[model samples]
Target: MQEFFMDYGLWLLVGLLVIIALVFLLSGRRKAEQPIEPAVSAEAAPPPAPVPFVDPIIAAPVAAASVVAEPVVVEPVAPAEPVVEPVVEAPEPAPAAPAPAPVEPAPAPVAVVPAVAVVADGEDDLLRLKGVGPKLKALLIDLGITRYAQIAAWNDADIATIDAKLGSFKGRPVRDQWVDQAKYLAAGDIAGFEAKYGKV
Candidate 1:
């Protein structure tokens, strides 16, 4: 049913509208050209002439002829046939259908990258993070990770991505609490650093 409607919906709608319009047009003309008020009986006795409604619209020529005008006899055609005025009526409008709602597409996913900060001295000292030594510092620098703030900002995804590249350093960030140390180092909070993880 759905497939049939999908293929022929437009044509069916058009055909229905055409049929409706034709009906209205034919009805209008039929009403306009109705048969005169059921033809008056020809052999029956005729009604009296000079009726007010029939007199004015149909004119009083019969009354005038019946009056003392000329001596000529004007046969009474008074009720020969009934008078009819066809009425034309306006076509009623069809109801309109509501439109369908619009659809919005979903947004695509974006990759999350950790931010790296550079200072006037060059870059933050990754060594300050207790677990990151000179070799790890060099490796971090090579991997474009030069800021303590960057390490502090490592989410699970960032940690996973960097760990995948770190090889031997995998899981080191979590094991040594690098993010906690980096937070203190990034903020230059020496007192806080010593309070938590000993001297800087």
Candidate 2:
């Protein structure tokens, strides 16, 4: 081994130094060959604009010079009925019965009047006088007063008996008044009769 080193030692050292220099020269040449490139922007280009369409214009409206007028009317109406009347129907007459054959009145009975002469013009049916209605006549008949003299004969008590028997007359004076009227009737006096009853 010592002998081989001695023989090739210088040649190996020289060959190593030559290889290192060659690598340095090649690295320097690669750096010189690299070029400096100019800088370029990254922005993109814009597209073209679109065309527009035009429309026609319209005119304003015009007004008329004169206007016509219209008229209005109103009518009065009658008011509704305030009250209504009911319809009236007249009553029909009742059918009549056939009358009996006329019988001649029996001759007037002979009166048993006292001897005093009857005044020819004196009213016979004194109850028929004005102011003496059917009710009063019935009262006199119940009291046995067939004539004015009989009524005149009645005392106050007798007249009261008549009143009690007749019950309350719906609208006449008491028995005293009836007796007094009988007395006046016997004398055939109208003024005396009117004094007890109002004007006939």
Which candidate should be chosen as best, given lDDT against the real structure?
A: 1
lDDT of each: 0.81, 0.61
C-alpha root-mean-square deviation, each candidate:
35.8, 31.2
Q: By TM-score, how accurate is candidate 2?
A: 0.30
What are the per-residue Cα lDDT tens digits for candidate 1 across 82-195? 667787777877776767677677654344456556567888867778888898889888888888888888888778777777788888988899888988888889899999
lDDT of 2: 0.61
Estimate the TM-score of every prediction.
0.43, 0.30
Kindly list the per-residue Cα lDDT of model 2 for residues 22-135, writing each as its tens digit: 999999999989997656556745545765643333212222324445676767788887887887878877877779889999875443322333456642475644446777
Error of 1 at 28 (Å): 99
Q: What is the lDDT of candidate 1?
A: 0.81
